[model samples]
Target: MDSAKAEGFAESLVDLINKGALAVMISIGHQTGLFDRMAELKKFTSQSLADYSGLNERYVREWLKAMAAGKIIEWSSEPAEFYFPSEHAAFLTRKHGSDNMALYTQYIQVLASVEQSILSCFYQGGGVPYSAYERFHEVMAEDSRQTILAPLLDQILPLIPDLTQKLATGIEVMDIGCGRGKSMIKLAENFPNSRFMGIDLCAEPLESAREEVRRKNLTNIQFKQADLTAFRPAGKFELITAFDAVHDQARPDLVLRTVYESLNDEGHFLMQDIDGSEHLEKNLEHPFSPLLYTISTMHCMSVSLAQGGLGLGTLWGVEMANRMLREAGFTQIRENRLPHDPMNCYFIVRK
Candidate 1:
């Protein structure tokens, strides 16, 4: 309403649109591997880059200029040379501690689900649709293991001495919703004494998981098609994990109880999931949070509701989770403070 306020509002609006466009450009650049290649030699002319990467010259030329204009790179307009700016090092190149390319590129699936965001699951409820159930199961698992699980294990496993003890001699573990078992392979290798069994609903990702296991000669890992909802753990589990999967189960509280009963006494149940809808405004600050919310709404919630049209799977908040875990009768309900940033919370309930 005031002049200053109006000026600030105008700037904010411009920044909003510019940011959206910038994200698209950055994602395209990463998908095109422009930054990675550029970081290799540090500098190259547009023509040379097009030839090197075998991309269309005109498209590459325009893209490079846009990167310069977006401040992602600096352009020598005289000779048309493009040099990657420092930001690329901190994010686009692996030199940056986080790399963050996976954060951007892997999240493209959210965009794929954008069309269905308006199809409110509230009107329909129970029954995960046939197609969505399959897709959601696969995508969510792969995304979770890639983006969060390894990082989680790297952080949480050390906290419990049992894991380190096993790593000394090696041990075996089970991963729920293990999808293609990419993360499990690494976990198996990390703790040589550890073998991992990954269980999922579909045979497709499970097959891939099996292939990866065989490829690595990881005798410690295996894949199975099973539902955590009713499929009891085959044996005592040393380290059990369901990254963002268990919370969406038809009966989540029961699933938590199942996880509780399945674990060896004192073994940890690590459930990495986002239940921060209570903090919608705050969630925007964390990109993955928003992306997860979008997926939960479109694919996750939508699919869960598809079967009988039950909207029971619509994103549940922390309070409900706490209530459910309490009802399920878990002994301890400590939040894994450092497992995930605030946006993605983990319920480290001790069995």
Candidate 2:
């Protein structure tokens, strides 16, 4: 090996190792509400921050130092002050709500928890079940709360012009794989005239959705624990939505066809999933490619393979998605990318 090239590789390895450790620290900060507490205080010493957050001071100090080293927060030597700048606070704290990165960082620990199962699949050629992922529904719901529900009215729904108005005037809508029913609930609450039904294979999330509906007193929305591939509605719907949900299904192609059959003549379907390239070489250039593929291997692909499914995984690119939509009898398909969300591809399809 070239000496210089070898040195560069070593440096890159160090950087990645540091980043991995820092990611766990970031997750810890997010979970413990340390980031939020620091944002509220603006600037504080380790002891003060620990007292404010109800955490141990020594651990807090080490975490603060890590944050400073990671360039996530500002550190001062003279007065030993740690500061969360407003700019950093915006992305790091829950104050920015759905726009925060801390919410996504929580996935690091969750995915890592199943490393053993993922390894077993590598050797045994079998896959982990959905239940293998503990807290998956909860984390997924929190993720939806941040990425989808929190911005639904202002950002996501408005992507289709006049679509909101159609819902406002009363229309039948269905959401497939509607984990915890965050998007549907939001839509139902915002448009009481519209009727919404959410379906999922998992009972846990559906139960949570029903409980939330009762709490919200929403008459326009309902949740059912039904397999998407086998589900048939009494009547056709005017609109359908799937948010980061399609790739995980055991029979995603069948699910697409079912959605096509279940919609009225002019009905539209909106799907949001990982933005990826069908070509692996092209995907290698993507910023989130490593994480995406890792997620697929560890969770998305594994769960589907466990069921003897197609295992499309999280990185099913628009190229493949478009072909599938066309195959499912969707004549009009548009691929869109939002400025606010870089992680997903938005597919607007019409029958």
Model 2: residues with Cα > 4 Å off, grouped in runs: none
List model 2 lDDT by residue over 241-297, tens digit each: 999889888888989999899989988899998899778998988999999988899
What RMSD does each model have against the real structure? 3.8, 1.4
TM-score for every candidate vs. truth?
0.81, 0.96
In model 2, the clashing pairs are none
Clashes of each: 17, 0
Count of clashes in candidate 2: 0
Which window of ten consecutive residues has the lowest lDDT sum in model 1? 125-134
The CA lDDT at 58 in model 1 is: 94
Question: CA lDDT of each candidate?
Answer: 0.65, 0.89
**So what's the TM-score on candidate 2?**
0.96
Write down the TM-score for model 1. Answer: 0.81
- Report the number of the highest-TM-score candidate: 2
